[model samples]
Target chain A: MKPVATIEGRAIPLGLKNLDTDVIIPAHWLKTITRDGLGKGAFETLRAEPGNILDDPEYAGAPILIAGDNFGCGSSREHAAWALADLGIAAVIAPSFSDIFSGNAFKNGILTVALPQEAVDRLLEVARDHPVTVDLDSQTVTTPFQDRFAFAIDPFRKHCLSEGLDEIGLTLASSAAIGAFERMEGRPWLVPSASPANVGLNGTIA
Target chain B: MASRPRTLYEKIWDAHVVERREDGTCLLYIDRHLVHEVTSPQAFEGLRVAGRRVRRPELTLAVPDHNVPTTARLGADGTPLPIADPESAAQLAALTRNTAEFGIPYIPATAPAQGIVHVVGPEQGFSLPGATVVCGDSHTAAHGGIGALAFGIGTSEVEHVLATQTLLLAGSKTMEVRVEGDLGPGITAKDLILHIIGRIGTAGGTGHVIEYRGRVFEEMSVEGRLTVCNMSIEGGARAGLIAPDETVFAWLEGRPMAPAGEAWDAALAWWRTLATDPGARFDKSVVIDAAEVEPTVTWGTSPEDVAGIGGHVPDPDSFADPAKQAAAAKSLAYMGLAPGTPLSDIPVENVFIGSCTNSRIEDLRAAAAVLDGRTKAPGVKWAIAVPGSGLVKRQAEAEGLDRIFTAAGFEWREPGCSACLAMNPDKVPAGERCASTSNRNFVGRQGPGARTHLMSPAMAAAAAVTGRLTDVRALMAS
Candidate 1:
């Protein structure tokens, strides 16, 4: 993970509501073991349509995406966020996000900013003709036309995004405390099937 | 006067928090990790790429469910279904190979008890009370029924748990839903949850983990409890839970994964103390009368756009908020439904009864019970019952439920999530409407351009028999 302060580029104005993870990356393309090559599959169906924003060279390789309400509305497949990142999307502007998707997006280093629909509609129009910028440090999405819309983010998440600290990194940072906690009386919860003692299902796996 | 006591959510959460940091994040020990074919391959790849080993392979379980075909068209010598698509086949193969390489216990598609990830974990006791569980699928919240603090995670988080056996999580707000009074005879857990979601829109449970308490949930069947918890994700909840009790213990007693003899007794003793204190406080609470709930169905794409089976699609003008009005109108238009149209008269071309939501034995029985003496309506094209697992299929056959479904013109087949999603070969065609018992009713979820109406198993069966969205309670009466 790498820290990111601001993303400045052309924005793909794909304001489609209820744009589920499946639409972002169809299930057929989820077969690959590696996250590589997912950008080609991102918005596979939409990319097929004529004049699709994903296909329009005007917004090619854009890092900011302006999406409609309820973006990432279905499935817990993190591939949706992964694919978006692979397509060079650093931030998504939506009215709201499904809880799971928002969590996934954050974990993947993609900023999700929720603004009112009117603000988003304005951004969609501005994004068409000029570049837009999302500054995580200031929590504002600004367009060259001086359209400034502020957003809210959890302070903790904002720190993580700026610090590039993933869960593993955070755990390593608190390794000393984790060691103390593990020294307590309780053992890690284990399945009987793999318990250290002589077990019924299998001879012993642990 | 000082304060209400800590809630069940707080107790379980406090017990699991290993280390709390000033940054509003904490490390929680995850007791179990459930993985399925669809979402885990990339996570495993990440592990291989990073040269890391599974921290606690024993605590992780994998299964192939979402992609395998439902019908049991085995090879000549009797083997697993010949996978139809290359993508689904590759996903399942990748899961099997990865689980074996990681030294995790994987319940394969051919395993008699193997089924949807959510159903297999609790029924097998891999998920237990007071434990923290996670899976890459949202419906893993279903495991919360057994009093575990279980919820969904993404592939990155899945890999995080695989490497550390712990998760860095932000605390969730707690809400309590109190449902009193007895449920009417014909009502089911599906109806109760749909009613709740309808009252509170899809985002109602955002950032909160809900504890479903009160007489209705306390006395509900274990299967019914699973059904209610299964759709908790649809409510946008981090998870939904019921306190552990004798019923849960009785259900877990002899399962293969449960502790035995002395261990079991010790586990039960601890479980008994896992209830919310009487004076426990919640950040938010809502009370509802279970008796007032009707046989419910979602008429549109979102779970919250629901109504009673006997009611009509809501008029967009009924919503005072402009955004809500636009959403309602869009949903109705996308569903090809007219405002003020009787929901009962909405013609159905397909009826699919299977999914993690309602594919267990109890669900099959409910649907079979409705189809016992009736045939599908003249207009219905395809109606099928795909069991959740190979064991569920065999049990249905043993009880002649398969014959009942077949006689009623329904295709009774082998188990693997079938019509709930289009990941496999079984899917409703474009421009058709399907009465489904799955948790989600998202557009094209059943297939491209296929409209899905979410409902309970009985409602699906009734739709098959009546060629429309007929109320299951009405059919039970007449």
Candidate 2:
């Protein structure tokens, strides 16, 4: 979960649009609660094909995937991200991703890099012959041909990734602040319960 | 201060608002947290590291459905299928362990009463009107059949609900969809929803919450409402809701979790008020003729690209919008269907009539009605009917529905999401087309190179018998 400082790898190009989570890892694979062993089932049907990218020796151990537009659509299953991570895909280059999928991927320490279609086209071309490098520090994706394309991630996500902080991690990091808020309980000051319902229900820990 | 009157949605929305932030998101209190075996493990782990307990154990429930195999009776070596795959077994085991540790109720996979979480929620009366319910499963919107403010949340949201019993929301606009008159004899709730979706188009209800109203909805059985609401997501609606009425109360009156006697009376009194008022305003409205809905089916990829069976696939060029035309053309080519080609001529290799959407007892009966004394088409690779829950499975068997299915050369299997996405062993092989009761027919949804034509259960059954996507109306009329 370290802040992904840089990503350098080959791109296994999956040139399909609206690749939903059902297609990514499938609903059946979700029956397992553990995040383990999902790599085997990720895109099982696709892998079943003789020359699928996952099975193709040429793309073996690729760390980047260049997907078509509207990738990661459908059910907001986090396992989709887990499966991709387990498959060693560190970054996904797409025109866009489903909002929920991007959030899940970000939380799991996978970089979802959005780029212009032209840049994506170029990278896809470059991907056919050589590895690509993505540097989070510089926010740039570079090709072995010395071409570099700058990208952006949400500052908050960048911070979270840099700090290895999840929602709970961030919340727990503010334990003292939370303790101070708790001490404000019963006082006639400092963020009283918003509603009468909240008098019993909101953050009252009991 | 502004003093605008509150709408029913606003009242209910405000009642559940636990906290609000500057970002304009309301942290709403969730009263019921329903979890299935599939989506709870990670959330439980998130809690363990935090050293926290489920904030409100009494308000949570768990069940297993997604991974349970229905028809794989034994292994190649003749041993019983030891839960088919290890992942599902581990997930189920984790659910059992977590529910036990948290003192929460869990309906285990092998339990005679186990089934889909959504079906069990209302059938057992655990989901009530005017309360907020959250489940890790997306189809949790199925609980909205009770007029509850129900929504499906992600696993992180699940963890949030477990620890805080609340979720962040940006709220949603309300739309009233009114259906009048009675449905024609052969038409079912599945057809009605398809008719609505066809008219509204997918993404019509984006950022809105739909309240299904009118005499048609009022008269619908709970199962019917669930069938309609289950596909709300398909229509791109945040959620679908129906107000609680006498029918709602009656449906929940004597179930396991329903309040008894006086408490039930109090609950009913409150539930009755969950409806929209006479003068309540909606952001949008749509009306449909209940009688006009036929045994509808989807011929193309997206749900909105559907038309009534016996109708021709529409010509892309006829549409003025280029994007729409492109989409239609793509769907037409992928489905191997041409413009003006009657949908009835579309041959199919498989027929699946089961999923959280259309696999209830009522759905089974409807399919059985069509398949009575009929046999499946020759050389069909797969034709099966899967019930949604264990209760439906048992009820179907007790009533000889299973025998009718078997007699018709259809496989009657245990309850799970069978062939819905063809994720497990049940799948349509590459390039095979199928008639599916489950929602979504996106390319390869059932399996790689598998084509799915979404239809009602009866239509699926009719297609099973005919080996093609035949119009059920023709079969029904025959």
Candidate 3:
């Protein structure tokens, strides 16, 4: 994960609503074991269209994306976030987002800013001609035309994004607490007995 | 001292909280973790790179389903056949090696119990009442039907749970969707959920965990509830819950992984108390009349672009919002549909009666009943039935559902996510329309440029016989 403080660049104004993960990176592109090189497949379908904004040279490698409501609405695949990060997008401004996508984006250090539809619409207009600035420290998205929009994000997520924290490392530090909870719950049935005899019902190998 | 009334979600959250931060995020312990091929490889690699061992390998189960071919897995000599796609084969091999290296219990691709992760979790009793289940796939919410607080996670969170057995989380708001009255004949749980998604657009359930309330859900079978809860993600809810009751307990009692004897009794005692308390308030509420729901199907790409089977393709001009209008027009163009055309008049070249949403035994039986003596229409080139699990496949075979399907010109396939996402060999041809029982109708979900119309299993069977999207009720009457 990379730290994201302030990003200033032209924005890809993909203001389409309900842009799902399937559109972000198709299932065929998901066969790779590694997360690198996904940017080439990011928004593959939309970019296939001639003159699409994602392919437009003006917004190439833009650090910010202005989108419509309900962005990243389906699938919990983090590939959507990885694709965006690989595409050099550090922040996404949408009126709303799917819960899973927001969490996935935060984990990858991609800031998801939830602004009003009017604010997103304004950004979409300004982004066509000018560069936009997203300051995570200030929790605001500003444009060259004096447009400044404040957005709400979970403080914990905001902190992690700005600091580029490794969430797995942070959670591991609380392993003692986790063990204590496990002991206190005292539910043996919750833990399945490890039985190697049950590996495969037919016991065949490919 | 009396504590405030708590919703089922609140009770589960409070019970699982190990430590709470001042910012309100908690280190919540996860009870069960389900891993599949596509999402777990990267997470396991991360663990290997970091020299991390799975904290609770016993609590995790790995099964390869997404990229596994649904066709024959074994050859004439009873040896497992190789997967043709190199990328898919490599991905599956990675899972096999990672699970073994990490000491996680894995069900091999040739295992009889190996299936879709969501289906395998409940079928094996790995997902139980009052438990927190996490999977790398979005359809993991289907396990919530058994009273688990389950939701999908990304690979990063997957690695987090594998390493620490807990998640850093914020509480979600509770929303109650109360569906009252008796559902009309031919109106299945799939229709009810499709109707719910149609009524409340995809974003309606965002930022909330929806608890399905009222007689409609209470009377539904456990399998039906799973189908309803399975699509909670499609409605933008991370998870959907139906209070655990005798129905869920009965369904789970004799499963291979369920507790038995004294442990079962103790588990039942605790599970009975996992319901929402009286006077508990929800952050949001949606009341629906069950009678209002019809045999529904998607008319366009998005799940919300749905209508009753009798309805017609809506004109984009009918939409009030310009964004919605443009989306509808684009969907129509992609789907090759004309405005004002009756939904039933739309011809389908393919029929797919399987997915996490509708691939269980009950779903197979529903499709079988509709195809009892009928044959596929001449114009319908392909139709296949993929069971949710090997156990489900065996049960259906025992009940002769496979024969009924094959007799009706539908192929009886192995248990896997075949043609659902088209990650495997099963894919609808480009430019072809399929009446599918799967959850999503998104563009290219089945295959690149493939058009999907979501419906119930019986509706899919009806489409197979009619070569068009026909109401199952009408087929039953004929």
Candidate 4:
């Protein structure tokens, strides 16, 4: 996890809504058995077009992507998130994101900032060659030019992100509570009585 | 105190609830979880960040599909090329690492158990009656073949279910879709679903749970039932389910995840009791005649906007509903289709049979049957059939289904979600029209400006050979 809450970097503007995961990384590139080379395939479609966002020399080394609303709307392909991270995109600012894609991004240590459409539009205009700062603690995204936009994240997600906690983390955090619940009146139904090796079953904690 | 008899839906719903909130929603426990390469990484990451072990790792199963390459090695020029695409590789790698870290059992690429998550779940007996199963994919509803309350969930929710084995859900109204009588020879499960979607507009089943009943559904095989329920979301239903029966039990017997010996016998007895009672009531009901259903195909973007094979396209002006008429007109304009033209005349540039929607062994067989000894349209750019799983791929090959497809000029590729969307290199060129067996036909679903005519696998095969939307019955008759 990144030690700092705010990440300030150059932005690459991609102004389009509903830009699905497929466009981020085409399915043909999924044959390999490693995540190491995924950066090469990220935004291949865009790169194919002349003067596209990734191919523009002016935006070289952009670490932030200011995009349109409803980004990453199709298939729960996490490679899209991996590709973005590998491509040096530390943060993504969009009007909204597919719930699955957002979770994938967060898990990969990439920040997803959901701003209003107007804010997204303004950022897209200034995103090119401009450095943007994102502060998770304040829940705000700002530009060097005095533009500051605050956003909201699910409290649960915020907690996980802050603590670097995942599903396993959540389960371990609540292990004691889970243990107590298993001992309640609904014990028989919640825990299998016959499966002795499985924990929470009958008098067995194995 | 008097208690009214509860519907099968209500009974299942109540049994799974661990807690109820003031809004009347229930925190229902998820009895089983299915995962796929496409959706598990983030969920696993959430688990890691939370420092949690899978609450019930044994309750969850994973498989690799979706992003795996199809053809062995053929570059854009069609020469023998090595199959190593970086994006899919990363996705697969992440899944392998994540599942291993979480102690989740997974069927990797080409493994006997590796297939579409929906297909593998039922085949392995992981999907059982009266259980609440959750997956990160929408087609999880296919598990309802066993009378289970199965549905798709978001990644965060996947994380939730992994940690607590419970889902927080809003209550939904119950709807019964009853179809009785016999389906004609040429008609299949795909046609029946298209007919239903035609009757009820795409959004008709919004905010409801669907129960499929009647003689037609009763006679359908487990796979057929799965096909019907798989598209419920396309019609706006939260899920579609069927009552469990002997066929369900027979299908589950002897599978990898199934109970054995005495346990199996007891499970069968319990499964039998999971069916709906005779007098159970629903919030709404619609009755349909199976005999009236014909081989149907979608003529436009939405599944509901479909017509029979030989039927002329609907005249937008004939629709009394202004909104529907307007939508029809828009669809027709975008599709470049003329009103009153026979659906059989719509030209197709390619044919694809794949996706979590309809890539089962039966679907492949149907396509093969249509393509037997037939040469495809001379100029058709592509005609391919992709099975949903490695198990399906092997079974199809064992039956020589691959030979029939290849002899007919179709490509028989490895199992994966290929060309369902324009994700893979298998995409149809922009502005081309295709006849596909996959479910969705939204605007540009196959590619930018690409027109998709959704049909059954056999129908897609017929179109591939004829270069147009021809009636599969005619081909069969010939």
Leading candidate by DockQ? 3
Q: Across residues B424-458, which tens digit of lDDT does each residue of candidate 3 receive? A: 99999999999999999898899999999999999
DockQ agreement of candidate 3 with the native complex: 0.54
The residue-level lDDT of candidate 1 at B155 comes to 90
On lDDT, the candidate that comes out on top is 3
**Poorest stretch of ten by lDDT in candidate 3 chain B:** B254-263
Could you estimate the TM-score for every candidate? 0.93, 0.80, 0.98, 0.74
For model 2, the docking class works out as incorrect
Per-residue lDDT for B151-192 in model 2, tens only?
666777788778766665667888778898999878888888
Off by over 4 Å in 2: A1-17, A28-32, A36-71, A83-165, A168-206, B1-8, B72-81, B180-182, B284-292, B314-334, B379-381
Clash tally for model 2: 0
Any residue pairs clashing in model 2, and if so which? Answer: none
Q: Write the per-residue lDDT of candidate 1 for residues B1-478, one digit (tens) a residue.
A: 2245777777777877778778767788788888898888988898898788887788788878888887665667876565777777888789889987998877777666677888777766778887888999888888888888889999988988898888888888988888989888888999999999887677778788989998888888888888898888787788999998899989887766777776777677777877998887788888888878989988887888888877898899998767678777877877898889999989999999989889889999999999999999988899989887666787889999999999999998777778887888889888789999998887667887788999999999999999999988878888
- lDDT digits (tens) for residues B107-207 of candidate 4: 76645456778887776666777777778776676787668787766566777778877765667788889998889998998998888878876556665
Interface RMSD of each: 4.3, 9.8, 3.2, 8.4
Which candidate should be chosen as best, given TM-score against the real structure? 3
| Candidate 1 colliding pairs, count | 0
Model 2 lDDT per residue over A98-162, tens place? 55577678878889998987898899899988999988878889999988898987666676676
- Give the residue spans of candidate 3 off by over 4 A: A185-206
